[model samples]
Target: MTIPTDATPSGLGGSEPAVLSFQDLEVQFATDLGEVRAVNGISMEVHPGEVLAVVGESGSGKSVTSMTALGLLPKNARIGGVVRVTEKDVRQLDARRLRQMRGKDVAMVFQEPQTALNPVLTIGDQLVEALQLHGVAYGNAAKRRAADLLAAVGIPEPARRLKQYPHELSGGQRQRVVIAMALSCDPKVIIADEPTTALDVTVQADILDLLRSLKEKLNTGILLITHNMGVVADMADRVAVMYQGDVVEVGSAEQVLVYPQHEYTRRLLDAVPRLGAGRAQLGIAAEAPPIITDEVPALEVKNAVVEYHRLGKPSFRAAEDVSFTVHQGEIVGLVGESGSGKSTMAKCALGILPPTSGTVAVYGEDFNRLKRKDRKALQKRIGVVFQDPAASLNPRVPVGDIIAEPMVIHKVGTKTERQRRVYELLEAVELPRAAFNRFPHELSGGQRQRVSIARALSLDPELLVADEPTSALDVSVQASVLKMFMTLQAEFRFACLFVSHDLAVIDMLAHHVVVMENGRVVEQGLREQVLHEPREEYTKRLLAAAPVPNPEEQRRRREQRHAMLAAFGDKVVEIGDVPHGPEGP
Candidate 1:
């Protein structure tokens, strides 16, 4: 099933045979509510050496369609039509035969590698287990093969990594390990489900490069399932736009992304936040900068250095001389990679983690100098919105109670007053007042996050710390939330410290930007100065790694990134010159 290099990009009815194909696929799940039709007669295919991306928002049936291809749907699923992997019908295979077919014919790389991997097992153990399960190798032979797989995926010191547990590796390394396991048996096609969704921008670029390299080297087809339009631009040869259980549009990546025929596809593209677009692109009017005088800022950090004390080892420095200010009625975005101390700085600002040295001040009150009661009192004026709203809000508690709990703790008002405040907060966040009685799990991801925002604002805090608030949401929901956030901040005049890895998000919201790398602030200035015209190499690299939604623009950026990386003495992650994987000794 080899596709010619010059083959036509259109995938709907190609001349070359498909390595993976879905014919009139339909899936219905029998839930407590009734039968839910997840996929409706959607047909797609992945030719050898081609990347076919199935993209849509959450509950659009993209994931459901991919699940059917692997026969990974649950027992209650009522499936129709044919799913073929490597020209073999998946539904027709028996249990034992299905197990044999899975890793050999097709494989999957899940969104969260932490969940996909076994926590208790070493990396080598899991890799070896995968190899042995597919009868690829045995004992020491398997160990050698495992190391080779890791190296092939661009993980350095593969032999040393074999002994490390999942928790010991960084998010990027863990994803690489998962990818190694997927490539262990040398499947004909790989199903990657939002593989880079949880990664930092730089790490995501690396992983994308690795996947691209492997696809070319192994001549394997990839069925990429994701909601990120930038990733689709960077990866897909052909695109399938899924919406409410139907394939609304199918064409070459350029046609589908640039000149989308479907309304839903256009809407999806509209929702994507483009880098460097800033507030103007979102139709948010620019505000005059707040006047700064001798008056104290809302939150200030001066020469702050935070370190974690390890038992035998020297203290690990997380933030080194990190200094920044959030003025009244202003938003300052802290942008960086995962280990770059963005969250660490947020925690320190929230007073959850105290800096080992220097000072954190809130409106002229120094956190380190204040007495216990005084410090607690100062904290009353500060609000915090965490990244994942589901974890932040208590599942058993009603939304009203969750929002009013802060007011209750501070003893701000009577019970009746608190109820009134809760209703007001709900309206402020654009959630219906009826939502006050519902629990966290009963709401959608967007609604839950809105509840989290309401809870954070309950006490009418003058300062707000939002830590990756919209990272987990779908594009449209994120757009809605971001718009609401800007409006609320303007109305409330609250100074905010927004911590996120997304540069585009920061560009949309932040008046000032702080860029960090390896526990130090490399650049800080006005948003335009730092993001658009960055002077620091680290800042430039971070901006370069952030993908744009346009295919042509993204291709240009990718080329510039490679050139920049080479000039800066860095290398892109490519398949290493290791032993040819499953086919070789």
Candidate 2:
């Protein structure tokens, strides 16, 4: 089923030619070991007023191909074949001519807005600079145009936002600012590289809507690079699937996504977590036999309230009166959007933050009331998995040492015994023995996450707090990690508090669900009850906003969501005027 859009081919007039094209493109990077071919001979084109999605996992040459079109490749890289923008060959152009074509003829929207935007400059300064760089506008004219761009992207109070820096905005707002900057020069083509990968579902839906509207209004061609099949289903008119430097499949969005002919494409589709699929269908084991327990729960948080004090203003309540329980062998999912206090709740559970008003108990013992030495001893019974393994793992340490560090800290074993345990943990996580000597930088994202998992389990903790552990991974990798997590939980009978914004993932693995909104739990019950028969309007909104890989279903869901919002007189959620500091909510 295809999600129909109102977009029509009218960008720069219907008489215009293709905005971007690639023919027999080949790219290679010269390295000390050998010459590595990144992109094999491949061909594709993007016309004005259409979105052409390039979908693949990491190392599939998706980004490299798009980078070549922008002339952003390194000097040492060898490029072959033709890359054209509006009939002009980008390869034949010199540095100055290429610079002129970059913002005027083509522009790019990056995956991470924080890195793409300058931290020191105001949004107005950056947007105006982009316009002036292409000789589109300057001075008062540039400011006015910048404000217009911001308003066009659906950001409220465009004029006031110009004075704010990138850090002052939320993740969704930052991304909108990036899109506004891309439109400053009215380029014919926009290359969006994983634009919504790090965003929440509602925010992603809003961004996709804005892009579709822009395509219809301006007729700008879009080259969308992403690995998410749902995104392709929602946005693309045509699809190109890449695998290990080759174009494995190409067709219309409906044809490619629903009736994919290639084996690789089918595997990608199979790896996606469907909302209603049971554990067996998703490659996870059924719930383990209920753990025999006395009266004590594995973990408990009662009337928890966390606050952040301010120097000159009222304190902020991050988590208010939140309460939940994770029984032994149970996985309770905490679901919410960004700034919804999910992380704050996780921190409170981990005892990293002391709640101001309530108690956190582990196996019936109050965590905050324990003595210093007793608290240290209790910590050995708890494990944690952060969102980004690269940030959590020490870069300089070997995988073996990293895994063994927890044991070493708790004085669990000798050097030789710890070394043997490292190899055992590696095998348990399905990693090779050689990985024991590799550094974090030497491994893939999935491998690093596995290593983090192994390290977390090294202490053999009774409870685990996994916060968005699979959010950054590709679909296939995420599936494998989740399956492994389920298997390990079954084997060890350890309780878990899994926090994420992905309802599909939660539906696949969780026994109970807790829905959060603005630092409070709006709903909590068994998964079957909360997900299937949601009682709160906010939970229904979240379920409605989630995009399915089926285009027709997603379109239907979008329409229903819009109608629901209208009925309630509720506006689309936007980044509010919260104070932007180093600390997060």
Candidate 3:
């Protein structure tokens, strides 16, 4: 908890001049409901060669506060107080000067790189455009600088990558490209907003390392905005905790994260899922009774092999010889990094993707062999929850109808009966009955995910396949959803195939664990055997890469992971090595 003062570089402890500073800042929006206060009177500073992380939940003004520096807020937004960058007040800048200062004096790295970059443009084109916008370079000179920037960010084959489109690059690569663009003009201050949220653990670690190195090399101040405590622990030299549009706490990383003075900060840290903490520590109830009788397993996948055939390339196996099982009243966790075939296995089990070889059985019946009618009948007993509920739920449909669609398809009840079931489902998910009339967009991310869960369970299916259900949610929202899921599983006693990249969540919910890599099952066994005493080097690497909330522990883990990767050499699985399948590779 006590980080040595010497751990940070000299002159980084408030003695240096600030590159960016906010004084008595406040932001308000004019909405249909009324005037909404997004950011209250807040003051902070980002000093040269230091990371000042702003940690908060969604809608806590983290992004809004950062965006104000660039004048990125909507025209209708009302702002007050002073925001200074390099001794110049941003609010006082004209349109022309603001545009010039944006990428030159201050740059931003967005959360999702896919949306941040122009999809139609090549990576080189985007980088060149950024440089040319600030009058840094143009034409052949810009192209050369573009490739150099890519190389500086540790990307391989920089020139060839420049020729490729954004879609061609992996998530990690795209993020690096975004970082490259941000570095095109060598800005004095960088605002990174949830930079690694969509990445896998190994990729996240690499991105954090890249950011840290960039800060040191450029001596640029960084204002990091994120909801992830692990990211804050790993990157921040100082921490500021925001709650309900207010800065509730601010101190050194060790002081705030380890010995928080505010209750909100402590609660935020507690919401994080700690590695090896187990379900009891997270307040999850005991596991449901075992379904160990001599009966058919709830779901069984045997030596399954699934392949995708590209138009001009040779067919590749997405899942090769993968096998696992989930008994009634049990939860089997499918976990791995990106392109590890975890979701491919889940899809094969859900009968959404037919295997090239081997078999998938549901309640002792071969799913591939079932007739159309029989398959439809079998589907009535299955439910699924995907990662992004906003994408999964129909925005045009009401919540009640979405939940009742399953009953209607199966012709199991009359209209009145369906309405009753809808209410029951709403209650089961702990949603207000008034939500029945609301659309998916009208609710928060966590609320929409709960609605998705309610719809999935509407049919009272005996089996459920959840694919990274909590990955997109905030930590506190995720905790509530997880608790609800566990409670539902205990009540219904349905078998579950839970797919996720988060090891802490997997450890909490899964009775059995299955680890995959490059479409192959590297390890599978009871949770205690696989998690507590992992034998596979791959599993060890994964465990080592997962960040803890404690800054000191996370620092040690990072060092250990670096050493392990060094020892393993080329054996580690690189990101974007294979195409992620429908469920994800």
Candidate 4:
């Protein structure tokens, strides 16, 4: 059940209200420009036993405001607000007292578990100390609770996993462990900051359901921060739309999501790429004519099969009969779900892993049978863009030098020539000259991606291999980047192999579509043929699962639920039987 939004802002001090409320909150950071109001005057309340979703794009103060409530901001940061929790005003609380309250009264599950979790500590030790410090029973009590919490979060074989390190667990399992830790204290409030931002769709659905159920069962309030409206629609009881650090819209989930009143909210929703719906074209459009021949494709893969061989063991087939091509000046979109071996096919084309059989030829030169000099020459004509630009870029070096490195390595021109080219490349990526001097950490996620693109273009490659280039960016920024890619291809006439999990993006950028599943291509044809006129069950499932632009899709789900219950009589179906549930078969 949702809390009453019109509830008066009860004064903080004497007694605790439902839970952690931010009244007239304002957070600012001192910079050369001045005190940047990161979080403008905003008021929000997360009552006990409800999921309050805070939705916004980058620079929207979603993170900053949540960080303030937990007293997690830096010392230099100026915060003006009243944060109430555990019958105490947290904003004015002393450091030691606030420290005592955290992980007991409240806890947070961060976005990147790898970065948040201490790499050196084993999972058991981390959980044990976290529980013991909070005085949530000692020794075996804490261990037993930790194991139970793990299983509660759907982690398999908790006892065995306790000894395993963070690195040993996959991304999804690590997220589960993080969730387990969040619930260890049985905190009154849980702040999950973009908790499912990096997970796969199906995994994301599972995590959402897990959190929703946990919130209900434990009577814990949740301040869910995310940019995805689909996710917000699924789990939020109430939604607070933040723009320019201010809460522009705050209302029940049904009201805000179904009939968004604010222009900004509408724009934000509009910016979301509807994977199954959009333009009728291959979805990808080019401004200029393609620069390839009809006789031989720019890059051709013929019945390519790649295997990973371990000593004294049978080799595993990484990619089976994967065949596709990247024609010059045209884009080929390869779409798939997570763990579908999309990356393996990319690696094979890059020659990082040679295919066990079949042929890969670029511009009439065979890649598998090529020598070092020949392969190096081929590298000059192919560029790759990974999902996480921050990880790919060198932290120590500036953007200009990073971009110029590719040109310098290939010995394209003189020193002055290289410097001029770097400037031009930065300009092409729509980044300011000042960005040339800043390191990767100094820039935002979108800017870092632009730098990565600039570097990839420095070598003037004939083909670009982009893997989830826009997945990390905000929708508005993602759209702009897609347009930029189109413009770049039009100008340079370079072919692109765009790889993405989101079908809407693939449709908008790909001239043709190749759907991959279980390390093999299930469908490959014109974008319209593959996306709109599907011939496979998996393709239909992908389309049905795509993010809906309007709230009508939400209605469809409700109606579907109603129809299912109507047909199945009054017998209860397991929670896992629900479409978005864990066992959604």
Q: What TM-score does candidate 2 reach?
A: 0.88
lDDT of 2 by residue, 1-585 (tens): 111222222342335567998888999999666998999888888888889899887678888999998999988799999999998999999999999998778999997788789999999999888777777776887787778778778788999999999988978899999988787777889999989877877788888888877777677899998877778888888888899888888877888888999999999899999887756557565654475456588888889999989899999998999999899988999998878888888888777888889888888888778898988888899999886676799999999999999999999989999999999989877678989988997676657878888898898888999887776667876777788788788889889999877888889888889999999999999888888889998898888888888877777887898889889897653322211111111
Of 3 and 4, which scores higher on TM-score? 3
Report clash pairs, candidate 1: none
- Name every residue pair that clashes in candidate 4: 275-504, 283-507, 283-508, 284-508
lDDT (tens digit, per residue) of candidate 3 on 1-585: 222334344667457667888888999999676998999988888888899899877678888899999988888799999999888899999889899889888999997788789999999989888877777777887887888888888789999999999888877899999988888887889999989877777778888888888777677799998777888898999888888888888888888899999988888888888878766757875544566546799988889899988899999899999888899998999888878887788888778889999989999878778999999988889999876676688999999999898899999889999999999989876679988999987675567878888888889889999987876667886787788788878888899999887888888888999999999999999888898899999899788878888899889988788788889883322222111111111
Count the clashes in each prediction: 0, 0, 1, 4
Question: Who is ahead in TM-score, 2 or 4?
Answer: 2
In the range 1-585, model 4's lDDT, one tens digit per residue, is 123456322321113355778888888888666787888778878777778888877778888888876788876689886878757788877889887788878889997777778889988889878877766757776667677767777777989888889987866788888988887776789999888766655456557767877766666788998877777877777788888888888777777888899998887777776665544323345334554767567678889888888889998786789888878777888877766677777776676767789887777778767899988888898888877776789899988788888778788999899988988878776778888788887776667878888788888778788877776666666666677787777788888888786777886777788888888999889887998889986675555445444445754753454354456462211112111101110
Candidate 1: regions farther than 4 A off: 1-15, 288-294, 366-377, 388-460, 577-585
lDDT of each: 0.85, 0.83, 0.83, 0.74
lDDT, candidate 3, equals: 0.83
Q: Poorest 10 consecutive residues of model 2 by lDDT? A: 576-585
TM-score of each: 0.89, 0.88, 0.88, 0.84
Report the lDDT of model 1 for residue 216: 80
What is the alpha-carbon lDDT of model 2 when measured against the actual structure?
0.83
- lDDT (tens digit, per residue) of candidate 1 on 1-585: 122334346543345678898888889989776998989887778888888898876678877888887788889999999999987899998889889988888999987788789999999999999888888888888999999989999898999999999988888899999888888888889999989877889999999999888778777899998877889999888888888888888877898899998998888888888777877766677663463535699889999999999899998999999998989988999988878998888988888898999888889887778889998898999999987676688989999999999998889999999999999889876678878888887675557878888889888788999987876566876787788788878878788999887888898889999988988999999998998899998998888998877789999999999999999999999877544445323
Best-performing candidate as measured by TM-score: 1
Model 3: how far residue 571 lies from native, Å? 12
